[model samples]
Target: MTATRILLRAIALALLFLPLAGAAAASCGDPATPIARIQGAGDHSPMAGQTVTVEAILSQDSRHQGGFQGFYLQQADHQTDSDPRTSEALFVYTRRSLGEIGDRLRITGTVKEFHGLTELVGIKAMTRCGREPVPAPIVLTLPWPQPPETLENMRVRFEQPLTVIDSHNLGRYGELTLARTDQVNATEYLEPGPSAQLATERQRLQRVVLDDGHRQQQPRPVPWPPGGLTADNTVRAGDRFGQLVGVLDFRFGDWRLQPQATPELLPANPRQPPPARPEQPHLRLVTLNLANYFNGDGDGQGFPTSRGANSQADYEHQHQRLLAALRAPNPDILALTELENDGYGAASSVADLAEALGPSWCVVTTPGADGQDEIRTALLYRSDRVQTSGHAKRLTSGLFRHRGRPPVTQVFRAKNGDTGVRITALHLKSKSCRGATGADQDQQDGQGCYNDRRVRAAEAIVHWLSELPAPDNLAGTLVTGDLNAYAREAPLEVFRSAGFTSMVHQLQPCDARTCPQYTYRYKGARGSLDYALASGSLQPRILTAATWLLNADEPRALAYDGPLDVTSALPWRSSDHNPVITDIRL
Candidate 1:
């Protein structure tokens, strides 16, 4: 054969072998790195900042609008290593949907750690070699047996049912916190100490958030709980869900699940009606924190008041809801907190509420005794049911001069000629740390800020009640309103040290099946901030007491100012704290 003919034959042979060489390089059997090696046993990648080649299958495509601006890549099932400590997956920040799910591809990029997430960015080359089976998701449960970093960026399925522990962020972030079981406030059960600290830590391990896979704020059509969220359809904190399939991820200092498919919601907690009135013929009393019930200048003009409502429309909605809630229990007297400090005029919040109740409802006048705080505790009673005996008194000395709302006390006699009873309405300093100092700051125990102030207020209340002159043969003395303290807190201990007793605890002790009763929920834990404590004389006369599950268990999205429009007249979420209803034989 001629020289030119031989050269042409060699060229043809080289073309045939070119594909074979490319296949060998793309196999990632030799110089290229395994995904598990890059995602070492530690939180970050061992090959961080280094450009290297990797072969994997695309597991998730999330490069659409409102997505995480990336996709997930995981080692094929047959190719992943058996080392359970190391992750066999990574997040590829492509900023574009380059490949379909289950597409096996060879890629060259620099490894980067973005806010604790190991990702591959600045891609230099990418080639779709062939299709591969996506890795099967590993089952996981709360109180994880090992550090979740071991399964970082890998698909996972929850084995046990998860309870919705918190929906506070449901409207803002479209995320719901899920836990192994319902979480109660540590201080509500155990006194603030080493035991409480341990319990708080245990609660942290059992919880994880289920994110909607989007980074947008206030995502439209709140994603979880099957149906879109509405005033009627709500996902409460105690609801349960199962069959959660997602990728374990860490962002914003929380370990969350970016769901692969919709989870199944099991409604363990349903909306309940207000507590029914006891069948026994006894006087009924209710203590409720109005949650800053400011009437915005009381008329129709003032818009955006200091606290409660932002507009006249919002104020009207709040007023209507509060009326519905107060009328449900059919209480003869109301001990209310967080009412607007505006005076007892016809347009005042207290007067408006009392007038709305009926023609016989009357406000217990304090004259010049109300405190300087923007909000004060007020008392109202039905004139036809109970008659006021003496003047109303308030404690303005000591801590109440500035910090706490003054305690208002009054004596009332039943219209049927029964013996007189003394009742005091008081609201203590809140847990807010804004102006807290000295002994009032957070002690890092289960109890929040202002423990000292609350304890002092409790002592003052007990002393003030003792000093006040009472009618001869008084039936009993009852202290009621928002104490701003849980059952096991220092303030409650002070009251217990005295002769006072919790009426609710008398009927439903903490040892019962439901254990500690909660009237408020915060940061995912439930506890009571409102109470009805009776003196030694009144303890035995207490027929029954219950914390009406109206407000705390319901979602804030159903509130007057929330995203929902005007619809039902139900008093589901009239306020942040639920009302405590008690019946007494005066």
Candidate 2:
């Protein structure tokens, strides 16, 4: 054959072999062969024993079975974005050693068709080419678009690693800091003043000692940092530090690198005392159930007209009386139960009380489930004595099962930053006083059912309390309210069984008639129902416990003597039960 004809034959043969070569390259399961890449979603082609390299983003990283840490990487920009298909073509790596969130990784392994979905088997990390670009380090700044309302727990992220070089105060309002790349040639100093003043002052204070012991006096600030922050503008310290090109986090008001990032430790002062062991502050909590603290009929029964309108007048009187009692006791924390739920109209009641007590007193109230129509529980505290460190949690029992009422609870930190206490206030089922002459039979199953429900509530509360971190330093718990269950009732016993020590039991006994321990009176018999119970852990520091019985001096006839007194039978005068108070040293 001629030379040209032979070349033509060779070219045809080359074209025929090209498709086969591409197919071989696409196949990924040969142990001896390195799989360059694999592409497919469904289960039809390259069924099994095919080694392949799949590209995806690390979606989740968690400990897997067989003592391995597994991570799931998912395919990007797929139709799965719309619905169930979003999770298709997923690869699972059952290896504990893996990258973290937002990592773009490639895995080489054999495909195992398990349950109709393709999964990677014996997967190994691969340094594959053609990956997505990693995001640039995030640059943060002060007066940030969404400046954090509070700096106590703020965090920021960046593209590149950075270190804190210097920190300087900006008056009492805040401070500023300078951060730079570890390999930067020049040093950076954070000083108070306008950028120009700061730049100039930084030169003057070139050799200043930093909190972190390291001397970070730099010749001058970088002429132009990433964010318009130079040495000229009087940027707030927080604003300047926030502008640093790295992850920033606010911990208890001080700006620092995030936990995931490298942390810069300030050098300790040799002259300063070694950090002292923190002591739990002594907290005094008094919980009172001001029973129906209203002059007129709160439920619109219209029997207590002699007192005044149930609107503002009744609330004012009760609020005033409560304030007087609070002043007398002078407790640091007060938990009030059976408060009127009069919506915004009744906001004045709490506000007035807070005002009467002083600027140091702070009050937070949660309206009853029925809005402002029912009785609600409230917490009043001396801001100087205690600071609310966490969110408030409301505790409710099974609907109408317990006392036909729900309760609220809150966790607070001592103002001195020493103690943490969880306080719960309750208003349990009250005794029914409907039909029946002034006889014992008229009491019905009110007390019995009330006792049972309270017992259930106590069991639930105990279970919840058990889950809390046990007290480390100070006694860490207290439960108070108008339990409505007398001291000797089964409900009280249930709480006692759950490690609560009743304060009443801790006090001296007195005559049943005129005892300071009696919190409630029915007909002619007086008893103790309002109580304060401390956790078994706090039994040692319980300094004093007693009942104030604010209305004990008033004649019983004066309270229950009104017209509808026969129908509703509730006292028209102040409250039938008095406030229970206690003091504990932490």
Candidate 3:
């Protein structure tokens, strides 16, 4: 017989007995061999529920959920003059204890019948090839030919043809699993079907012909499984679903079958909206980074020291003074830097302030460790004046240095409802080193080494600010912090270049007389380092910017003046640096 005639006869015989084989396999005892070798079964008896082992090349091992892994093994079981019966089987491991991909291993499992399909279960073990992961294959683009009325189950051809082993719907999307040949990787081709007709045609020609000419001429009719599509003819990669000439694997859970090509009705496309949510109205937001509110001696000899009686008594005095200074400004949103751990704990200090300030304020503080308290940068806001939105983000950069906690960022909504703006509070690296020159001098100059970290921090903030979507109304943005770097520093210039306007520009130097804006004092030389900066869009509405010299009148010039009296007296004795305040109108 000619090869084509032999292929046609073998296909006809297999199709006629396939249903009977499945039924017999379904009734076989556990571990019973299913469909014994053609030569081993003299009478062609079906083997079901049998434990059968077959050796073949490992085509693919894909991992899914449940720690369960699956793979496909293919071997040429029967070859004829016309066509070959390539036995492609699916195997699954209930326990995910298999070796890596591309490893050849002997899998022994029970053959089970699933809806007229055969599967290997209870995978015993596997061996590894110890190979590194290969780079993904390059995708092949081809023209799709033969545009059909609708594209359901149509076997369309492509220039880069693929052997379709399985196709099914995972929810609303269609999934196709094809065997990867030397020219293609099976996993890479699992993409959406091509929409272009020319691309489909090019893909169809890429496939290799499976049957001889004689077998192709005398094709056997195969019935569709349940709602399966009819096989009018063989299909290739680029062929339309309904057209014959391409083989398709119909997947239903663990059971799958190679169904002949058939026409399927296309469903209507549903209109959908884009994924973005509607933005909220813009509002004016301000963040204040109050300078070192240390409330301790300049010598760092306050708590746990013999400087004044007991350490606990000194801490109590310091805490009261800190709270008093905080109340004077009464800022809508306050970012307090250099908040001491208070010897008690990070939580205690925050809680004490929240309680003393009443329930209108919320405080977040970082704790300390060892003998030193965790001096953190904190955020305290008036709950009634601002609505907290997102979680606070901690920023770390070269400018901020690795010394203390990173700058914290939080978004707030104005309760007044005029403009909604995002606020960032920062405390850049400080210049406290006594003696140094050159770069060191510049560092001491507030625009050099010390300021370098601050500059980096500022740059980071600028980058973050750039990414935020602009509000529809161009709501003003503010970046307030204890910059350590003076206004003339290049880092400050960087901020200006990035669209920030300084509030200090509106104030005069204190000079001899105690000025309302001088926040720092070194050997009676008063200077301003604390600042409030605004975005260009909101700078014009700044009503007034001034510093309240809370502790300026103290005779001794001590850092803090004991405990603060919240009602009667002001708390200028809290820290060496005074509080800077600003009022703005939208």
How accurate locally is residue 37 in candidate 1, as Cα lDDT from 0 to 100? 87
Full-model lDDT for every candidate: 0.83, 0.46, 0.43
Number of backbone collisions per candidate: 0, 20, 65
Q: Across residues 1-586, which tens digit of lDDT does each residue of candidate 2 receive?
A: 9999999999986764442212222332212221112223222224366655555555444343321134445444431233321222333546546566456555666665544433467765453334443333334432232322221111234323222223222121122233331111011111112442333333332211112211123212211122222222222111122223222322233333322222333322111111122244466676766555443333335434433334444445455555655666667788877665544233344554566789898876554442222566678889887877565655553443333455556677677675666777766655454332333222232343344445666677677667655444544577888776666555677788888877765774533212435565442234567778888776776667776545532322223222112222222224556666676665
Pick the lDDT winner: 1
**Which stretches of candidate 1 lie above 4 Å from their native place?**
1-31, 511-516, 565-567
The per-prediction CA RMSD against the true structure, in angstroms, equals 5.2, 27.6, 28.0
Model 1 lDDT vs. the true structure?
0.83
Give the C-alpha miss distance for residue 562 in model 2, angstroms.
7.4
Ranking of candidates on lDDT, top first: 1, 2, 3
Best by TM-score: 1
lDDT for residue 49 in candidate 2, whole number 0-100: 62
lDDT of 2 at 90: 38
Cα lDDT of model 3 by residue, 143-202, tens digit: 212221111111223233333322221111222223222122111112212322232333
